[model samples]
Every structure is written in C-alpha cells, then in structure tokens.
Target: MGKKINKSSQNGYHHNNHFSNPRSKTKSTIVGGKYIYHGEVTVEELAGALNISSADILKYLLLNKGFYNINSTLDDEIIGEICLNYGFDFEKEDIVEADDFEHYKIEDKAEDLIERAPVVTIMGHVDHGKTTLIDTIRNSNIAAKEAGAITQEIGAYQKTINGKKITFIDTPGHEAFSAMRQRGAQVTDIVVLVVAADDGIMPQTVEAINHAKAANVPIIVAINKIDKPGANIDKVMSSLSKYDLLPEEWGGDTIVKPISAKQNIGVDELLENVLLVAEMRELKANPKRPASGTVIEASLDKKVGSKATLLIQNGTLHVGDYLVIGTCYCKVRRMTNEFNKPVNAATPSTPVSVTGIDGIPQAGDQFYCFHSEKEARAIALKRAQKLVNKQAKNEGVSILNLHDKLESGEITILNLIVKADTNGSLEAACSQLKKLQVDTVQLKIIHSAIGDVNEGDVILASASQAIIVAFNVHENSLALAKAKELNVEIRNYDIIYNMTEEITEAMKGHLKPTFIDVTYGHAEVLQLFKASKVGIICGSRVTDGTIKRTSKVKVYRKNNVIFEGNLASLKRGKDDVMSVKEGFECGIVIDGFNHDGDIEIGDIIESWGQEVEKK
Candidate 1:
C-alpha cells in the first residue's frame, strides 16, 4: 500500500536539517536566526526541512511565522505580505519577461459561451452622474415588476438593454480607484466617461482617461447633463479632443452618447455601442476552465469575515475551491454575491462576493486557478523563492542608503508621492520636485495625488517603493503608526521649496548641514511676579539667537542638560518679546516652572536653538 500522505506526517522532520534542499541553502546567513528558503523549494519540502507543519509554514509566512491558505487569489496584497513576512520576496520576480506572465495558464473547459457582458465602468469628475447612470440602466432593464429592483448593489449590477446584457462596476471617484487599478484587472470593456457637458473636463476626468488608456481599454463618451440648459456638449467634445478622445461623429473611433440619467435618454445607444466594441474585440471566455482573474475589491468586513468581491473574466468559481492570488492562497469555503447571499457557483464575467481565505486580499489582485490545494502550495513556494532572490539583490537599499544611491548615476532617480490639501498647493509642490536636480539624478514625481496623504496613497507608496511627501496635507493620524512599521518615510512640509530642496539635497548625498546656535543668558524669579504650576515669572538678558521665543530650551540648574523642554513663555517687560539682544535687559518667564533657589540675581543660564538651513 502507498504511504498515506498527511500534513502531520510531513511536518515532523529533523529541525536542524530542515533546509537541506540545494535550492534553499544558498547561504547560511539568517534574518532572524532561521534560514530562509533563498531559492525555490516546495512547501512540503520546506515543511520537512523545518520540522514544522505545512500549515504552520504557511501560517506565519514561513518556518512557523504563522500564515495559512495563502493560495487563494482572493487577495494578492495579503499574499505579498505573507510572502515577505515569511522571508519570501515577490518583488525579486517582478521583472520576469512578459512571456512568463502567461506561463501557468489553465485552459477554460466550460462550454458556456461566456458572452462576457460588456463591462462599462463609468468614470469622471466628482458629482458626475456615474451612480445615476448605472442606476437608471438597472431600473430600465428590470421587468418593472421586480418591485425590489436593486435598490442597492454589491458594487455592480447587470442590466439588459436592446437584449444585450452589460455589467457596470460602480468604481469610486477617489481613494478606491488606485486599489481597483492596482488589481491589474482593469480590463475596462468600455469606459463611459461622464463629462458634465457644462462643466467640461476636470482634472480627475483626465486622470480617469489615463487610467483607462493605460489599461488599454476602449472608451465610450457619455456627455451627461445634456438635459440641462447650461449643458454644452460641443464644448465638452472639444476639450476631450485634447486628450485624444474625439467623438465618433468627429471621425474618431470613440463612440459618443449624450444622455441625462435623470431623463434616462440615449441609454440604449450606450449599451449597443458597448456591445459593438466587445464584439469587435472578440471578448470570449471558457467557463469550463479553472477560474482566474483579478480581485475587484476586498474589505475585512466584520460580519462577512474577509469578504472579497471578484469580477471573474474567465472560468468558473465554485465554493470549496482553492486558489492563489499573487503569493497568498485561500480556500473558498463559501461563494456569495456582493449582497452576502450564498450562491452555488459564479461563472465568467460575473461579479460575486466570496467568503474564505486567511486574510483580506489586495484589490485588483490577479487570481489564478491551480490543480489543487497541493499544487497551489507548491506554486506558492516557487513564487516565494523567486521573491527571496529579488530581495537579496535589493538588500543594497539599506546598506547603500537612498542618499548615496541617488548621488551616483547608479541610482540616478528617486520617486516621490506628492500630495497637498488643495489643487494649487499640489501643483506648486509638484513643480518644485520636478525642478530638483543633480549631476545625474533627478527627483521624479511618480504619483502626485491632490488631497491629504490618506491610507490608499500610503499603500500605493509602499507597493511602488516610493516615498510620501505631504505639502500642506495632513495624513490620517492612524496611518502614521502603520507607515512607521512599514518603514515608509513620510515627510511633512509647510513650505513648498523647503520640501523639494531637502529632497533634492538628500538625493544628491549633500543633505542640508545641521548647525546649532548657543545662547548665553539667565532669568531669575523676581519676587514671584507671577507663579503657576506651568512656570514662574522672572527677568533675564542677552540670550543667543536673540532668545527666540519658540526655540527649544533646556532649564538647567546645575548645568547637566536638566529640564529638556521648550521655552513655553517669553517676555520683555510685559511686552511679550522674543529676544533680549546681547546686553539688553528684559523680563521673561518660564512656562510650567517656578524657581526657589535654582537661581538668584546672577545664576548663570544658557540656551540654544537648532537651525536646519537647506544646503
């Protein structure tokens, strides 16, 4: 009889001899006193080498860090994390040839002529009728009797117009777009750009167009608000032409439809145009093959528990399936719709919510189907190996320091995420960064998002290996902690040139020189002019740097750097002045302090302030 292979049996190997495999034993150097599988090795192979449960190895990322079921494409973000946490590095393998991307393909076996519905995603400026357009279509398609016709959606809804079915993904206008974009699943069949005919193209409209173009998806122009008296479709079309999106009537390939979602006109024409594009592109799917796709969106829902909504472009998704998303894998214990309703299976081109998986997956994560849980585990192991090698190459980042690298053409460029509170601030900061220069290095604005440095921007910066610079924009307080943990450097600057100049200097390996100014002066509590728990009023003279009121101060009694604190209060004879210049006599007070014997009329005092002048 064959040996009964069980997880327990594979995990009880010799611990010291765990990494005996040639692939993973490249070097003896250890990160946390444990050997990482520096090269490709099977999970089973690793489990035995490490003398730990296969499940345990998968749990923490590797060798008992404790992570599990990371095979499900249900999320890729989690998988990358799991891989990294366990000494696996996916970034190392990011440069694989385009050919390798389709390496592990699974043929769809489903006979279902997956007439992939034309997925028309409406994107535009804020307050544009994106939601209204989708809603009107959904309501129009319903049999007027489906009384409770989709008052709310699970992110998307399907509607049939002119007997052609289309699915519209209601992508958020902000914050969420990047997550959705990152999934690499943005195969927009047709992008219905909602340009307010009167308001014309806005900044975000241009961004949306670029995102769609980057995805290489077709676009369909929807001139919204044609019903309004102020609406000027001609002006909007002229502006769109600047972005190369000429209307069909103007001899461009792009289709244009003017409709008022409020009045619900020209909706049918939009559907027909989308289907026409789909047919031209020959969008087809085999539902029979193993399911694979990118995650639409995922959230750690309190009730659903790691809820993920996936838009399957091809193949069949069934409950009880195991899958790999990026580096993480998961078991599909439950399949559902965005509504949280249980379903037997979801097929190609269908959007469904799923429950399962060990953690929340990254939105837009590419998912792939595997032969089984075992195969998924094996593949994940291989992927993890490739990542480890990649990281080893990048380990130079810490050793060389970002500054040194930038100084040398060896690291000629640095990327930054530019953010600010308003459009003007954002533009000014971006202009400043663009001008920062060195011999060979240049400051590049890879991602410039206007608004506070929110969590979405934080995640993107982390993924892109970019730094965040906030100009007049306050980061969400909560992100500060996570940013620190990720070692993500976030710099805050109120002055535009100061921010850019520092970044430039740092990149050039000549960061602004740090200088300290010392002050020589003293203040004695004079008759307790005023006393409080904060400090006691007194008189003093001749503090260096004119004794800047806001300058940091050290209240030293015996001159041992005592009372390391700020000079909370300063006064010049009740005039609230900053400096008692050199020999000029002035009355001053210390906040949150009182003197009894620390000083008499001549108790010596000294102060200093740091000035970080740009190089």
Candidate 2:
C-alpha cells in the first residue's frame, strides 16, 4: 500500500489510512509535494513506501545509479532520482549530535591555518625506480639495504629543497604490498607516480593510479629511467593519457617530468614541480591544537616494546603526550624523527616514531591526543568494548555465502590473494579474476605473486579476510598448517577456466565441492648416493609429517618447483620402507627425475595428495 498525500493541501500531507505506513514505522512528513524521510533509509524500505518491489528498485539503481545492493542506504541524489520516477519528491532530514569524543573535530578559523609541508608518496611498479628516486632526493642509499632491492615496508623521510621542506613516503612497489600502498596514499597530500620510460606501464602502476585517485589527491608523473637504453618518454606519456593522467605539455593538467633517478638528471626540475603543485594546493593546518594524526606503521620491538611511526596531520605531537589510537592508548615516552634523531615535539606533516604504546596500533588508525591520561584510558576502554560488541554482531567474510552477504549489504568487496606458478600465469589469472566484479559485489585482488603460498600469505589473508587462490601452485607445509589453524580457505586449480568458473559460481552463492592439494610432508635433500638400479638416490631427512612411497612428490630448488612425479622408491638405512615420519633420514628416488645435478643438496621435496572438501 502506498502512502497517500493530502491532495487538497498544496504544501503538506495528512496522515491517513492504517496501511500507509512502511514496515520501518517511521512517519514521513510531506513538504512541497515531497516526502521527507528522517535518518538513514534502505532501498527496501523506500520501495515498500512506494508500493514497489525491492527487485525493481535494485534494477533501477543498477541501470541508472551504478552498483548498489538491496539493503544499501540511498543517498540524497539517488533518492531524488528515484522519487522523480515514482511521481513524487523526497528529501532527507539531517540529525546531528555531539558525543564524548567530539574533540577529534577541530573547527579552526581562517587565521589559524598555517602552511605545512606537503606529504608526498612515491608509488609505481616493482623496480620502476620509486625507491631510487627517493634515494636521489634524500641523498641516501636506502634502496641498497632492502632485501632483493625491493622495499618490504613503508618508509617515511623528509627532504629540504631550496629551504622548503617536503615529507616523502616510500611505499613498496611490489604487488604483495597493495594494502601498504593504499595506506600511503590515504595520508599523502600528493602522489608522485613514477613510470619507467623504458617500461611504459605495468599492473602495479595501474594499481597505484587507482589508489591515488581513490584518495582524491593530485598526481605528478615522473618519467624515470631516462638514462637507460630504450628510454621512450613519448610512449610513457601516451600510456599515462590512457589512465586520464595527461601531461601538461600535452594540453593536460597533470605535470610530467622526465628524470633519471640513478644519474640525478632532471631531479631538481622534479622537485621544483612538486613544490609548485604543493603551493597550488595551499595545504595548511593549525599546529596550536592538540595532535591528531594517522599511524603510518606500528611494530613490537624486542628491546623497546611497542613503537609506532605516526604522521602528524594537524597540531603538534610532543613527548609524554597521552593519546588514544584505535582501541589502544599510549603515553608517548620518546619521539624520534625520520633520521632517528630525538625530538621533543613534531608539527604538522612531520613523521615521527614514538615509543610507549601500550599495544601495537594498526597502520591507518587515527590517533588523537587527550588532555590527561585518564581521558585517553577511558576512551580506549570504551572503544575496545565497542569493538568487541561489533565483532559479535558481524561475521567474517566467507566465500561460501558471498552472494548472501552482498545481498544483505554485509560486504561489497571480496578480497583475494592470488598465487601462480609463473609470471605469465600470475598476470593471466589476475586479469581473469578481476572480471568477476558485478553490480552488487566487487572482486579485489589485494595481493598477487608468482610462487607457492607461504605462511606470510596466510597471515595477510587472515588479517584482510581474503581468500587464497592458487593457480598451478603448491602450498608449503607451514602455510597449509597455518591456513587450517586460521580457518583460511586456499583454493587450488590447475586450469584457469575451472578457477574462474568455480569462483563465479561461488560469488553467486552456488558453492560446490573444491579439490585442494593436501601436503603430506616435506623432506630435504642431504647426500646423493649412487644406486645401481635406481640411478641417483637422494639420502634425505623428512622434516615434517610423513612421506609415503605411493605419494606424488615435487622437487623444489630455491623455493621453485623443478620436478613433479611419483616416488620411485622410499628406503631407510638400506631397508625398504612404506613411509618415513618426521626427524627420520630416508632415501628417496623419483620415478623420472634422475639427473645428477638436478636434485642437489638442500633442495626441498614436497609430497602431496588431492582431497575434496565441500564449500
């Protein structure tokens, strides 16, 4: 039943008929021939008021207003559009109230605003000169210290250029650190997207662009590696245009500067452009108020206890300040700057690492200082209780009921970690999985790499509530045990078609039994023994579980699988054996692998079997 308005009155409506009210029982007032709904309203509730099916509302929104679920709250513009089609008008009533934690929002006057250093984030694909560019600017050899020359964590530093300071955030360009890069973008005032001139565009580069755009920050494109062979600045510029990042010289607003980070060519010009953009943004903050900032990174130090690197967005953070971050409260004991120098206070846009955190605050958690330790502790306790209550009410995202969750507006993004056998397979699998995004739910590949799943992958997936998708890749023993302990799902598939098909069906809530490789045990190659009949037999030690003679085995050298075949023979001390348990030495011979140098010492041999599980 539709609510009827008073046709006799041109300005308002009179409540009439007992069946007119919607299921929510919220009374609506008609003004200017439009219904005024109070507070938040869902699509189903609005549909019920309009005497229309919720499916119809969802279809209308999908076609005209983009993707939205049935329970999604309607914004003002969307509600107005829907009201137009339903032969009526609608308006939303705003309700505002102040709570105990309202001190977080400081309304500073125009006179209080002062210029602060612009926080810049360097982002690009792996080995694309992101770190090198920062190294050149800071005159430090930070990149050389990283493992494999790839940054593993977020690094914050400050550089002075022409008497003006600029804060820089060096985010890992690797695909596995997408979440870290996203956090960097959120706190940055400007994003310097580094694209290698020799290598036009890569997958991670596109991801960086998306992250910068999502943060609603301006981008300055730096065409790096210009001194290298095959440097094509024009090609890189053309590729940037495809992502809507047109160069200023090409009649666009985005500023593009060509620079060779290693040679320091055009580095000065790049810095000038960054400062010019910062000037145009006119970034300002009131440093007189209490400190409010975001945690860039946090960790537990064995010697120092809990430490967190925080970026002061506004006001000043001083040593011995009481702060509440997330559910944790901290009394700042010591403060250190980017160069590890001790500091008494840090102003706006300054990154400082502080000790005395009671608990490890997560990256991207907002922290605000309180006048006293009592206030901070009280707020932290209340937040902890609130978090516990929220967790009790909500369930973690699971692939089995993904469609149901989307329909109920519980989650709109399905996070996944993809692992493949090679670079080509990894790229292909990621590209294919990205197409599964639909009107109601989006598939987000937070991490992707070419290798077997490890314990680190399981930990990240558990923290992000993501599923692990392995394409023609094995799961190591530690990763498998961790996944089971954490209740993480690892779906393995040899065929790309089957992987996509099953995931598609699961997204629609049509889950089926999935076959996953169950690892039996892991063994290390010790010494090579020349067997007369079996050729080279590996004198090995079973490091985990149990290795059977009938099980399939994969020979791994430096974490890469080189051979896959059935076990030819299993022996223990010159005696034939059916299996060998952990901490036991055994002789293993592959059915087909017999090369002398192929099965070297220290190589890992993994035994596994396929098992089907119901989703």
TM, every model: 0.53, 0.55
Cα-based lDDT at residue 277, candidate 2: 92
CA lDDT for candidate 1 = 0.60
Using lDDT, give the best candidate's number.
2
Residue 250 CA error for candidate 2 (Å)? 4.9
lDDT of each: 0.60, 0.77
Residue range 23-92, candidate 1, lDDT tens digits = 2223112344344432234444444544556566454553443222312111244434545555544432
Candidate 2's residue-wise lDDT over 316-430, tens digit each?
8888788888678988889999889999999999999999988998876778766567666766876775554444233445567667767877666788889999999998999
Residue 253's lDDT in candidate 2: 97
Q: In model 1, what lDDT does residue 225 have?
A: 85
